[model samples]
Target: MILSWRKKRAARRAAKKQNLEVTSNMELTIPSHFRCPISLELMKDPVTLSTGITYDRDSIEKWIEAGNSICPVTNQVLRSFEPVPNHTLRMMIQDWCVEKRSYGIERIPTPRIPISSYEVSEILSGIQTAKDQQDAERCREMVLKIKELAKDSERNKRCISANGTGGVLAAAFKTFSKVPFEQNVALLEEILSALITISPLDGEAKSYLGSDSSLHCMVWFLKNGNLSGRRNSVLALIEIVSSDQQKIDELLEIGGAIEALVKLMKEPISPSTTKASLLLMYHIVSNPPSSANSKVIARLTEMELVKILFEMLVDCEKSICEKALGVLDEVCSYDEGMEKAYGNALTVPVLVKKLLRISDLATQFSVSILWKLCKNDKSEGGDVLVEALQLGAFQKLLLLLQVGSTDGTKEKTTELMKLMNVYRDRAECTDSLDFKNLKRSY
Candidate 1:
């Protein structure tokens, strides 16, 4: 490896001495205009940004996809990322490659024209035509074409997502969902695969996707479909419902939605699946229709969500732990829910461990959860109090006070300290306290 590295470095030095163009380690002596600004390589698919800078399609597309709004070369904020292909420059590069074959340069093949919105419109129209003619084979073929288009290039995926393909596919999903799953499995799968590729849908696309029939379709998949399908359903629903109370109510109206969520939580198919499901449930339970939140809590409690949350909290990631804690805090607001929370052997210990350990939000939720538990425990040598004390909950609560928290969390911590301090020496609580950090707490 060392010898190979030395040989390559020597070759690059000789190429510079001979005045051959060398931008990359591979030492391709290409013209300046033939190389992409972002990748600084021979442009196979050169695309010009509105900023008048050309970059390789894959490189610039990745930049835009990562949420960069400024052109890489110009550093100007992009109003829109409608990159046009530099066909003339591409031909020049190809011709130069052919002339330099003896120099070990390969001719670049003509790249396929990116799928346009007009082509996408035609494909959508063909699917509608097939549906109207009751041509199942033609409809499936059209849908499959769309599925393939979504995978062809990032450019194509953007076209399908932004140029009304999502809305068209959503309408088709509703229609195909009516057909028995066994009968329309292929067609439905194709539509869903394409939609998922371009999903977290926006504008009128999500509006159509939030339909009742669509919710039912996703719920069916959540309950009966394969792991991949179930995972997509959860992910799709995350975008569909968002914070829309009406859509959430419609999803809740579907009989099996929450039940399927619980079942999926129990035997989570994948980590992303589990996180998405937790996020969806948090949204649903937290935003129940006005006057119906209590009922929502009761429903979730009956589903054993408290137990599920306790199990999930054992050494989970910070974000997942934060969400689970958020939901558990809400569930514990119900009288029976709080009892079930600390009642679990794992709940109190997990709560204490995460008290000051995770993010500020998780710490807030953990404090709320522990406070609820201790407030409701009136028994002598209360299990909640004793268990918390043995786990060093007494010292942790004191530390939390000095570490600074939201006023509400600090108040709750102070309350918990007072409750636990009764079981400890009066001087012990104040003796070990870090007065400097405590002074900063004020």
Candidate 2:
């Protein structure tokens, strides 16, 4: 009777375990909530559902707040739109890999045409021989051939099935970088003319000007030529740098580029020229060089460049204001003296007023500048900064923090919070008039 009772308990336990396993498998088999309306594929990164709903993985938790999750297909409220979970996905992939490995499945086969080092060396030697002989026509042909080889090499460097849309642009930069200085200058002129005449090459030409090669050429021009050459090079560099948002860091790194650019910004020029110079100046100021020289900062302030930047922030042209604010961001990075000069220039109020009046890129830029200035720990614009906060600046910044799509705006939001926290802490510690009530509204 004891043995029979033990057998019955073991059987009951095994049945319960099997039932649980079955239930788990059934849960996993349930279909996902919705498919993409555009591609009909499972919703992936930047997933947008029907009823105009969208959520990235990072924001999905916030999006799911208040439990309003709904089906994209029928617009019916969903209890949950939980995905398969990352660990489950990883297990699936691992299982797939194991199965493939067991079956001896080959994904990427070995290349049929392997590169021969000896053949490459022979080709390089011939090219060198042509150049050594000073055979201009032969060398030009060799250069063209070498460019082709470089393109091939670049193609091979990328994944086999990867997109090659940017490859041509990359190759152009590579080839231009290797050209002699004289040839490079001529090429720059050609590219500039091409940009003016051809719409198709406009993007490519702009990219070429911003390339490291082009920057190197600008450095060469700055060091080797007269004042006029330096001015022209700076102007050219400014034009290229202002065209694309991604090249800002590379633009800041050129040798003596910041000082040269600041000099251009200070010189008296026509409104259009000044606007262009100011635009570049703003980018330089907002982004700042990785390393800045004290002398450069002094010269910029002495030349009244900071004041000019302040003026540009309130300029009639929205584009100019936007770029100037970008520069103001960088300018505030200097020591306390520079910060005071920046605050005394009435930059904060101008930016606050602009934020109210302009709602475009200029306003966004102005808000970014204010965020930087007010947040700086050493900033001396006490009443002005507080007034900016009281005048709805903090709310504007918070809104930007909440909705901004660009990485720059996101970073500005984070910095703004840090500064506000410092202010909050200071307010708590001191008998200084409690602007707490005022700041809270913001």
Candidate 3:
């Protein structure tokens, strides 16, 4: 009887152990921290909202999509709607899921590591070291890698740009620019491409790029590099000069800056490149260092910039045309520019055609250019007045006076009209188009 009782007790213990195992297997509970607050289920992808509350990405996104502006738990207004990924929590949840694979749980795949400022700095440091050692291949590789990272995402670009990448780029440019043109031309082009990619370069970054060596190097690129390189160089130069007037003046002092810019403008490189070149020229002529100087005018005209302006006036896009006209207006404000404009066969007719056709800005610039061309005693000669009358400048001026125009443009138009009237009879086409309705607002 004792043996029978021992057998029964042993059997009962074995059955009890089996039952305990079944119970444990049936109750697969998730940790509270692993569960999303909104769903009360295991979080597959946890993200932290701006209110410091964490939730599964799908659940929170659904909740926000339902027009719920406040946090579900705290009922607090979100500081910003941008949700940050809870990387640490995600890792923990992923690990737990892996350990529970026997319970039919799948492992969460590793997330792609987002590019950060740290990564940018590390890559830049490597580039600098490679460059210092004259490791051309290594430097090229690192620069291309940086360009890839910067192009991969806007966040990456912002982080890279915000973390002194400009100075790194400037350093790389200065280093590689010393390389023989045939040896590192492609590498320099890549660097300039990278520079233009992170554009509207900030004040500090602009200051770095605005350095004399950088300006000279970029000018060299503009003059010597290939098509894309020349365009990118122009884009980078725009950012550097756009920083301030001092930088613009400094760039103007560079020997080949204006000549290269004019060449870029005239070339059918790309609309964006041409537009940026025009903008750079506009800033230079409009700002200090005085656009009226004969030497400045001579540089611009010597490169056939005036001819390009007339061509753009008829064929280029509205913004380019406006800027082209603006630069022309500034150029014509000087005696030398006036002569260049008057000499160009297309200049007067194109200026007359754009008078009231494109935009108010175009009209203003057109009138200003004509005004400069016809300035009575201040101008070189009265021949431009007869040329203007023949080209129907008086008609456009009268139309500009009658139409809605800025006060400054109206003043210029009225002055031009009066000047043309003084020489209207000498020109072949002296008949003014109707001026009965002409009225100046200022």
Candidate 4:
């Protein structure tokens, strides 16, 4: 009995010690910026490569061992494998660890240098040789290699990008874009995945990729490619078109281009992709020569894009919702846009819900949209007014007056309220206690 008791006591002590270790690790608050970009942890031995990115030596060395020539952060090719020891950064990290010891952060031990640059160069050369030859096997290898390398660090991204990975991929895309579909489709999918991995091509790469042929190829891919390909293609176009008004015009000019992008907005793609598509549309619709804007707006309406925007308002980030609202505000300024918005059943209710504490900008856009809808004195306006009353928009307006919305929003909301009064006979306007209290409070 005494021996069993002692065994249990010993087990409990060991478990308690393990639990303490976990608790200490959990309580340590390592600042994200202090972490090694690759490992995302406190750097014991931080080393800066030629590309000027500091990574934990172990993580970066392992990355090099895996046959990657490019820096992970910048996606630029590493000129040399040599990573200079960042002594000052190490000391600062050590000091921080020591200073935070009371807060349960353990001191990071000094890190030792692991491998020489010669080994890294050997691995890189082999990978480059494999990539240079148009060997299908080698191209497949390059795809995964580039994808993993791009995932390591931001500095490595700059390195890969600067070192011409995008150009390499773009060159491959040019070659594969022409080949027979059955033969090259899989390889092209791999290339597209790699491109998606290192997306938002830098300015220099974007400049090279903004060709008419590139734009055409992307549109084709969007039309025919698989789900991943389509999403990546849209993101690639966003980078390619960027802020150049001419490129935006060129993108819209491609056949099925506007429709393809609008379709992407409604598709089951990730939120980020959807937001990117929206941003691209915003660029085209938010500012352009009025002639171009009119054409784009017409295309958007024809594609039923307004309904998609309303669907997005149901659950999206504040920033994304704000951008969508901004686009809605611009689109609804047109007669066709207003008709489309008013025609959608969910439009007014979604806008009304968002007005209740969604951001200041969102509220402004909602008010603008409501104002435009209410400005029409016909039955359409009366219908919207009735919906607003049913949705408690009247209470929201009174609250807005009390909370002091922006001059424009307040003015529009007040105008909407007056219009509601004008149309009260057409629709049974609610005069609930909240409405009465809001009016008195205002």
* lDDT winner, 1 or 4: 1
* lDDT for each residue of candidate 1 in 146-265, tens digit (9 for 90 to 100): 878888777788888777877777777777676464677667667777788887676566776677667888888888888888888888888887846678888888888899998888
Candidate 3 per-residue lDDT over residues 204-289, each given as its tens digit: 65666676666777788888877887888878877876656677667778787788888887776888888888888888877654
The deviation in Å at residue 302 for candidate 3 is 2.7
Compared with the true structure, all predictions reach lDDT values of: 0.79, 0.51, 0.77, 0.75
Instruction: Give, for candidate 4, the lowest lDDT window spanning 10 residues.
Output: 433-442
Model 2: per-residue lDDT, tens digit, 26-58? 533212332334344333333334443443332
**Model 3 CA deviation exceeding 4 Å by range:** 1-47, 50-113, 131-134, 179-182, 244-255, 287-292, 377-399, 421-442
Error of 1 at 367 (Å): 1.7
> Which candidate number would show the highest lDDT if scored against the true structure?
1
Candidate 3's TM-score: 0.68
Error of 3 at 438 (Å): 26
Which candidate model has the greater TM-score, 2 or 4?
4
> What clash count does candidate 4 reach?
26
Give the residue spans of candidate 1 off by over 4 A: 1-30, 37-44, 48-55, 58-84, 87-112, 179-182, 288-292, 426-442
Model 2 sits at a Cα RMSD from the real structure of 21.4
Ranking by TM-score: 1, 3, 4, 2
Off by over 4 Å in 2: 1-191, 194-256, 268-272, 278-305, 333-343, 377-381, 386-442
RMSD of 3: 14.3
